[model samples]
Target: MIETYLPNVDWTKMWDATVETLYMTAVSTIFTFVIGLALGILLFLTAPGHIWANKLVNLLTGSIVNIFRSIPFIILIILLIPFTKFLIGTIRGPEAAMPALIIGAAPFYGRMVLIALSEIDKGVLEAARSMGAKTSTIIFKVLLPESMPALISGITVTAIALVGYTAMAGIIGAGGLGTLAFLDGFQRNREDVTLVSTVLILVVVFILQFAGDFAVKRLDKR
Candidate 1:
């Protein structure tokens, strides 16, 4: 019955492609979150009046973030090819896609992180400092807690973007649903395959959004 309407759809290959897409998204999200969070914190803390404020450092960090965040993802992938090959040993599979995915997503996520952290109340940070809280304590206890909701929201948006990035990466032979859709579906004139792959990508994105919203709701005290 299922195959009646979509006979060209290869369930086995679709499953494998779905797994590859999920693998790429999951691994990249973890790295993007950590690296983005750190970058955000650094940007926040080093801004004009913050604890680690330094004109040169803040300028340099912010400039780098803006530069990478400004690049188109597909272009970024192409630009990173040499580095990706050097780091991943090949640029044609799920694992090889990681370097480009993370590098492209991280700076964008970092900017999001900076936005989330900036929304934090300065008085709270000042209070923690006045109480003699260590920098680490202030970061872990004050800044992070106060901005938890925003941070979750930001990452949620970034994760969704990463899904799109994975699709773009697929066009370049990165081995995911994008690859399946473009190579197996589009090139082979298999519309059903493309449709099925697109549907699966949407499913993954919806799940990420739902989970992120649920987490934000739980973490948000106000």
Candidate 2:
């Protein structure tokens, strides 16, 4: 029955699609982490009683994070069409999809980062400040290092979320396993292809989750 269902399908093409998905997911994850870390640090440092506390900066950053994080991914994708086009000169493909993914995931990661940083011991921060550490020095040396495990977990979560978002990007011509499933299965009514693609995506996500969990466990002091 399975043989009859998926006979002679071009799996090589599907494999290629999977590779593209990985590439897109990886690049977007890196960009999201960098941007989130910066914003998160900014949010933390500017919060009340911190070394660089600035009420207005904190409010603005908090507001932007909340606003962007609240916008649904699909809607954000559609809403960002013009911006995507402006950035990539085309609004349909991995290139176009990347900016959207970065925008959607970065602020979310920022909040996660802020939460992680805030979880650190306040006394530790005070000690770092008393040692004549600059704001940048404290963030890099004290907050980030102390919160490494939590940050790792956050990255793992963000990576998994990006996988889901990339699947949705299929609707906009972004080539990935999602596109394969949509084009070969949903649109064409090929259940075998759809099932296979679904399984592949699940496997990929599970692997990412496992790897992330392992890293978090290894890094975590608690």
Best by TM-score: 1
Per-residue CA lDDT of candidate 1, range 109-178, in tens? 8888888888888888888889999999999998888888988888888889888988989999999899
Candidate 1 segments exceeding 4 Å error: none
Model 2 per-residue lDDT tens digits across residues 146-212: 9999999999999999999999998788989889889877898887788888898999899999999
After superposing candidate 2, which stretches have Cα over 4 Å from the reference?
1-3
Worst 10 residues of 1 by lDDT: 117-126
Residue 147's lDDT in candidate 1? 86
Q: CA lDDT of each candidate?
A: 0.90, 0.91
